[model samples]
Target: MSAELRLASGGAPAPETVHPLSVRGLTVAYGDAPAVFSVDADFPAGTMTAIVGPNGAGKSSFLKGALGVVKPLSGEVRAFGGPLSRARRRIAYVPQRASVDWEFPARAIDVAAMGLYARLGPFRLAGRGDLDIARAALSRVGMERLAERQIGELSGGQQQRVFIARALAQGADLYLLDEPFAGVDAATEKALVEVLKGLAAEGRMVVCVHHDLSTLQAYFDRVLMINLRKIAEGTVAETATPENLRLTYGGAAQAA
Candidate 1:
């Protein structure tokens, strides 16, 4: 992956239309104040990017804005050179584990199969072939044995894997995950990292709202540091420097 983003005319890189994701001045607000402010970035295919920052620094807000899960107050988001609406089927998003309703009566396989609903349409149900695909996805995440288990009955890591299996079933070109490793066991974290790295190797874009700064370099090819605004972005070695961390975390830099 390229460590430095190439700049176009006027010293600003024009959005690379071919890139899997490109944002221009994207801003999102909750109420009177903006949570994510004027952020411009591009997430290229074949790379795993971590959006890292201090708590309340708009890391999750940035992902929500880019995906339109939460409406942005300003700017634009393009997926594979087109509007997000036109490219929804090619993208898969897994929200934070905490945000999910695990108590909902759904089996692991049932959750995985939901990824294929885009192709099933409103009138069609999951056929045998669809179930097979979902099963294969579960196996990929080492969750096949728990296919019949209820989502709420699984451990934190197991639940995360099931969600990843769902994303894999989508066969999406872009995968966006929000804090997939939070509260998971070390073994589960290792397995999840391997699965995500495999996707990047297969030429897919993998972006995560990541919190663990210590593992940023080990887990991601690129890092986008934010603190309610764009701080720095590039290869982990180049972007996650002491000065940048200090700038991003301020007095709480040590904790970060």
Candidate 2:
């Protein structure tokens, strides 16, 4: 599929708008320990791309780098052919369920409404339009019925869905999800996959940091094999070969 998607120029100067994400010489570190180094890649628009690697392979760090939560030691990350800060509104981030303190006092709807905070800015109350968007996002994730429920009462899968709904409410063109399927039920995983596929079909990019190699072929249109550096980035047919798997897994050949 073509990566390019048409958007109204709106009098902006004509610039080459290609991939939704472009990383060149990206390096990430944590207190003298470098996790990622000199990574270069382009994630095409309107596709589901998976970043797969073994544990401690810096997949999570890479996602954080893209979100600007973790500043890179060097290199650059661009969204929609522009700097990340300029295109921040066009990006939605779905962090791992474990990353959040679920005990925090908030309802499902309230959590989902946080997405609208970006548009509302700070020190402002959520208006009716924000509520409508929140409701719509919850409905998209099949969580509208639980809108009034406390966030602490949700199961792991439900909590993850709520976070995803929050991202949906942001109305972003690019999605970055970290370990979204981890510890979730099979039904929830299937539902999440469908939602992500729908997002990609709508000409929005969705990048997932996933671990399971068995479902790689079924879940993503493109895969990035990484271990501090990009090993490969291509379709399953091109990059998921046995040799590549050996390299990705590092001398371990488990049956997928």
Candidate 3:
């Protein structure tokens, strides 16, 4: 990750918030079939947390539920002790790269600038100030040199970085990322991990959906195991044991 992207040097201190993200009775369903059921968890501020489970697990669904992309059958999601919609600016979401069309013909900078659009309101074009923020975001992801390149032409890791840059440009305190490590090189993975750690160190909250168990110990401070319902939430040492993994993966598949 680029040093320029480091949490905008010396901003006002973050408020002493109890939970950056809190979910209670977070049940999600697609029509009559439920994906997640009665899940309750709190993601503390300034921490790096990972959500992991098998292919059929509702890890991605949980993220979508938190983002309000998918309605919950029952439950509540809060950010900074308020309604999620009220705190949207403080929350950034980076979806899986597969969720986007790479051939959509946007430049890296253009893609990053999309982050500013939500704050800019409807039908307004991005200005020079927005470009400056995009540039800073690209620099943070070590992709400043490729700011003008077509996003479709970049590697998977580079694409992921661009999305992250977009999130950085949003100036959010909480980030929710899905499958950020999929199909990326080791170097890119390392860079991404560094960026996440930097975010946490700077007193931001990051929650990622990940799969690889081998790197779990090094990548995250806490892990939330989930299937249709939350299996466990705590430090890796406290919750990532063999028993928990089995519980999260043992169930049948559900929608993302």
Candidate 4:
């Protein structure tokens, strides 16, 4: 996609390449309390980024606000240089697993195929071709063999993989995941990391709200540290500094 245009200092029309995801002066609140403060940042394609902060730091809220899942009190967000509504097809969001109702009766393939619902529109039903696409997605996450199994019947790791497969089926250019590795097994974590890294390698944008600071270096090339407000953002080595962590995590940084 082409980037949005901006006027230069001389008022001349200058071409400016917009990042895959960009947010400016964003703030989200619940009632009178603000979860995320005015934040500004840009996420480019072909990179995996980790959004990290302490508990109650609004990492998830930041994402929700940016994606329009939760209305923000203030600010703007752009996906591929346009409003999110215009870039919906290019974006895929996998919400926090805990927020999902796993008890709902649905087969693994059924769940994966739901990703195609956007493409199918409200009037059409998923056909055999759609199921084939979903199956291919499950295979990418190494869960093709269990395609017919009930989603609730799978282990925590397997369940996570299924959702990821669902996201993959979207064929989105930018992916937003909320704590994908939170409660998965070591093997699952490794597998998830590999799958995500592969997406970035394929020139897709991958952003996740991650809690495990130890794996930051291994899993992401960039980091956006926030605590209701953005503390710092840059290459992991530059933004995940001791001082920045101290600012973002306070005493918790010492404990971690």
Candidate 3 lDDT over residue span 54-86, tens digit each:
885788988899889998888999998899989
Q: For candidate 1, give the lDDT.
A: 0.94
- Model 3 segments beyond 4 Å from truth? 1-17, 251-256
TM-score, structure 1 vs. true: 0.93
User: Relative to the true structure, how large is the alpha-carbon lDDT of every model?
Assistant: 0.94, 0.89, 0.89, 0.94
Clashing pairs in 4: none
TM-score of 3: 0.89
Largest TM-score belongs to which candidate?
Answer: 4
Runs of candidate 2 with Cα error greater than 4 angstroms are 1-17, 253-256
Candidate 3, lDDT over the whole model: 0.89
Each model's TM-score, in the order given?
0.93, 0.92, 0.89, 0.94
Candidate 1, 6-67: lDDT as tens digits:
67668887664589999999999999989999999999899999998999999999999999
lDDT, candidate 4, equals: 0.94
Report RMSD (Å) for each prediction in the order shown: 4.3, 5.3, 9.0, 3.7
lDDT tens digits, residue span 100-171, model 2: 999999999999999988889999999888999999999998899999999999999999999999999999
Report the backbone clash tally of model 1: 0
